[model samples]
Target: MSSPPAHPALSCAGLAFAWPDGTPVLDGLNLAVGPGRTGLVGRNGSGKSTLLKLLAGELAPTAGTVRAAGGVGHLPQDAALDTRLRVDEALGVAGTRAALHAIESGDVREEHFAAVGDDWDVEERARATLDRLGLDRIGLDRTTGEVSGGECVLLRLAALLLARPAVLLLDEPTNNLDRHARRRLYAAVDAWPGVLVVASHDRELLERVDRVAELRGGELTWYGGPYSAYEEAVAAEQEAAERTVRAAGSDVRRQRRELAEAQARLAKRRRYGEKQAANKVVPPIVAGGLKRAAQVSAGRHRAVHAERLDRARERLEEAVEAVRDDDAIRVELPHTAVPPGRDVLLLRDLELRHGARIDGEFEVRGPERIALVGRNGSGKSTLLRTIAGEVEPRAGEAAARVPLRFLPQRLDVLDDGLTVVENVARFAPGATPNRVRARLARFLFRGAEADRPAGTLSGGERFRATLAALLLAEPAPQLLMLDEPTNNLDAASVRSLVQALEGYEGALLVAGHDVPFLEAIGITRTLDMDALTSPRGAT
Candidate 1:
């Protein structure tokens, strides 16, 4: 493999940032990024996006400095263009295109030639870039609002590629992309030769990076190679950390034992001296000297053991911190179980919005785990909402036979103004606050985290809170339908979702493009929405 560049393309020193409310997000953060792709990952709310913003000069640090080799290009988290602008304008080639067209005509203006400047093939390059990013079908004259959100992201990146920025910062670039768009972005990352830093949760995207930069507790930790390599290294480190903790724990216990034994021995010596003096074995002066010497020795001995025990405890604390196993979600929903031969869902001749139709009857029986897979704008979310009774089908009927809950792609299942506990309680009216908190704790939202307003939560935290509310509902969701469940979730939250599903014995219908995540959750059947909605489609 080629080594990283010798000189830094982007670097920051003693970087710090804080919210207006005085809550510090990042402090004394230092990073030096050279050539090649780097994937920045961490649990949600680790300030990865904030770091990218600082690097791109979108946000000024409360302290410290940022330096770069040349002009930096940044793709914002919510990248978009004015709906009225043409595709060429969004790609940053409108002016050049106009100039070239003017020169092509009989005008032959000097200013037009100057505007074109050596970039005579600008239109060709722009079209090529758009095609490379899976925008081949989207013509240059198309309006910005005509494309999907995912395509808009690609368009922004295409513009950057055409601009030829010295450094690029992509924040969750794949969050809005579909599988096809994501594949194109992966190819773009592979072809990029300059400094590229991407903050992403997509496993496939992280696997393409040359290095992994993890932001945890405001510190940057670097790992060589791809996502798998980083996981291996972390696993090995955690094993070593646990071993160190075990050894330190044993040492602390041993020190305590030894200290107790020494105290016992000192007490025995004092008792023997007193007994001898009482029995007149030594004169008064000799007895007094013996007692003073024993007192001094016992004091020193106990102090030594006490100090050793303190040191051992401190080591144990340090070792525990080194281990990286954060708290995981381990909720078991026995109440959500559906026995075999149960009819969980039924959809007969359903015609959803956007002219999508399921012409035949469809049924989900027992504890089936079905995956709804499709491209962007393929009506996956619409189908899920139809089944949940949130949206009316244009024709026919959709019904859920069992008690069910739907987790929409937006994760808008909770009341934003309410605390997490209160939201869960909203779904379970009879449950007490303590009972709600007890259930939330299983989803890793314990103590103050459970009391925090849902609006204040990170994306991952919001998912957890929504999940807690769903699974802990009164009748228990026997059929759970989730739409694009893994979007914008960190790796830890994904794992937590997997864990939650592992213990849930219910019918599940999850619509998403994350195939690996579907596999992880043990998807037993796959249904393609495109095939389901075609003219010859069936149940």
Candidate 2:
């Protein structure tokens, strides 16, 4: 297919901003976004959300300006509707409020009517948009207060789509949504004919965009394709940079060696001159010439040493660049020598319920790396929790071999007020402070970081802290149950976690949507919770 046309819908020219405390966020940043889907990526605290706010006109830049041609619709990170309003009421207010204001201003002319396109019919259009977003089955008169967080997000998305603004900006839109809801959101954006900009850390969502823009070191680098293509290009660049650094280092080393050899020869000649002077057998003129020659040789050695040092410094910088560009932080998990029994886990007629009806039932046996596959609200998490003894089954029963550890999806078991050392010590009481700190270091929480409170740590750090605590326990659990372990981890961290899991000999029950992660960890079996609930032989 031909490349999409670059019809600039949003432009930032020489943008600069800083906080009240004089902390610089964006400096001399420039960006242009065209119509169609574009992905915005950045690490935590990289100003992705700030840029989005600037584009949406929600924040004023300290310098320069942002220009957009038409109305901008922004999906805020936390969008909550009033509990008093029904779904239909919320949509109606969002879609027609602008037109209502214009009419109240007594500016309702033929042009205004034409611009709004029959404001009286906006409710019908709003309903249609909501239906397209899979909200049609829901009652419009239903209060938003009764809906779930995921549902509230969907309703807000539907409201934005119904407005049909010229530009749409979404910031971490899928952070709280389920897999099925996320897929639906992606479909809605794909079908929209307007300009779309999404800021997210979700690789799967980024892969659906037409292009990927990464914010690093206060600058944006645009890649012409999706996440996969961007990753390949970055990897190649890193490899080439590494090669250059290696060559430069080799040259520096050779120069240093030559300098050292010249110094050695000059030293030997100086000693011979001293011996001649001691014997009083050399002429004055010849002695002076020899001294001058030694001085010149020493100067040459000094100059060579300076040059080599400079070159080595430059090469070291190049190596640092290569390392920074490559996300390769490897985390090695300390595996315990625990042998699981033959019956790792057994679930007989495992039935669970959300309301009155049974959601699922199944039988699972030992040595089976079975995946619980189902859409959101299909009771996948419930099944895992039931197996972990966190939830009671409405019917049937579950049995597991001794020693089990459950990593809940929320990571709520971690005490936020305590330091990493304290948390690990709690889990492993006999472990000394030094041992706890050492274990935390393995997970990249080194030095003073190990003393930082868990509440202050980032999402990735919190997850690592939890994992470190689990591993340090005296007798490790043979059956490990993880609920969406990869949700908040970065790409590099996720790879490290997968590597650790691959080496694990214990039975694992993981509930996640990352297909590559599941494959990497060697999931050998598959079970559909939704299928389990259905009548036998329904498939």
Candidate 3:
């Protein structure tokens, strides 16, 4: 495709990039954006983050040019803020506000006037940005350490918004955010006036984008109007592609049948010609001429049918190529099944070590899916840890009636030196190697991937590996719990996780703020950490 005319916002041309290890992340990618929000989406390791970094000039591309009309503000996935820094300093306005304050006081100086700049409204804008991001309560004088992790993310975004750059890039902006904070981020996205691109697996945030740019196989595909529309379009395209594949297969079969019939007819003709010549019903020369002409005609007939068959086969191949193979795993977890009347878990008067306390009785019976939701500091992970026997509750009892497993968000269960297969085997000692490998394959770990050491796995890969190991554990984990499961996952990984959970008959207690994910995995009920427990929020 030809490049578009110059844009005032952000654009890239003939972009190519590779990692330090010579692993090609992107090649010949071209993109153009002007004054509208774009959601950049892809599976983990598909270079969505790499592309954003390249566009922001944080990483130089191997091949092409990136153009920004003005400055670019980037909020990286792990954009770290100093814990000791004040909110105004984090927002990059402390000096200016200080100078403004100096001028207002008795000690006015020329440097103060210079530092104030022409815009005296900086303080007002900074406060408004914070207010917009639902951080007004945090106070500008407060240190970053005083805020929760989710609030810190919003503060970073607030800083970016305060800068008022011409282009903004957000990578996983909603990673650890709760439902309220996510909505606040969504509002910020909605009100952004400049060119914006967000790389995140958060469906709700992606739903607010004006367009979606999907990076797959080292190329960018533009889909107009948000993630849901893109998904619908892809679904329709896959359906049409499958229909074409079926039609093409039928055509190939029909062409093969016709070619066989033609060859059979030619054989009969040859036999008839030979028999007639032997019987001497006609002159020898005429008989030979008849045979030659019949042979020539038969060769032409065969050629026509053969060509048709070839064309049909080519069409079939093309149709098959068009259809996507988004195959997810399917494995029956019968060993993990809990009978309808079985008691899975029970917690009474739970008081966690971090000053969080849970009152009243809580229980899980049979195979129930429960969603855990709350602000970042809410003790959801602590509750799960107590239930998993990793931590003792300060007050009451947390016990499981069945064999259980807990997969934490940090994913520290695997032994780094062991391969994925080895780790799973360690858990399921009774299972044969072949059975373990077969089950691992269903989790999308196959061949060399299953053989790779757990230490080298990416966040999403490690999550899958840990989940697989836990599921294949001894006694098969009739009760499974996960803390903030969607924090570091990409879209495909999230889908794979959801699908993997679909076949399990075990009781699930998943802690996270991804409402759509909870809904997708068929949650039987929701447990709000704020309502279920009380803790001194993150300092």
Winning candidate number (lDDT): 1
* lDDT: the better of candidates 1 and 2: 1
List lDDT for all candidates, in order: 0.84, 0.73, 0.82
**Model 1 Cα lDDT, one tens digit per residue, 43-83:** 87678877888999988899999999998999976576787
Model 2: per-residue Cα lDDT at residue 376: 49
Our tally of clashes for model 3 stands at: 0
Clashes of each: 0, 0, 0
| Best of the two (1, 3) by lDDT | 1
TM-score of 1: 0.84
Model 3 lDDT per residue over 363-430, tens place: 78899998877886677877888899898888988889988889886688999898899999999899
All predictions: root-mean-square deviation over Cα? 3.9, 6.3, 4.8
- How does residue 101 of candidate 3 score in lDDT? 90
**TM-scores for every predicted model:** 0.84, 0.73, 0.80
The candidate maximizing TM-score is 1
* Candidate 2 total steric clashes: 0
Q: What lDDT score is found at residue 458 in candidate 3?
A: 48
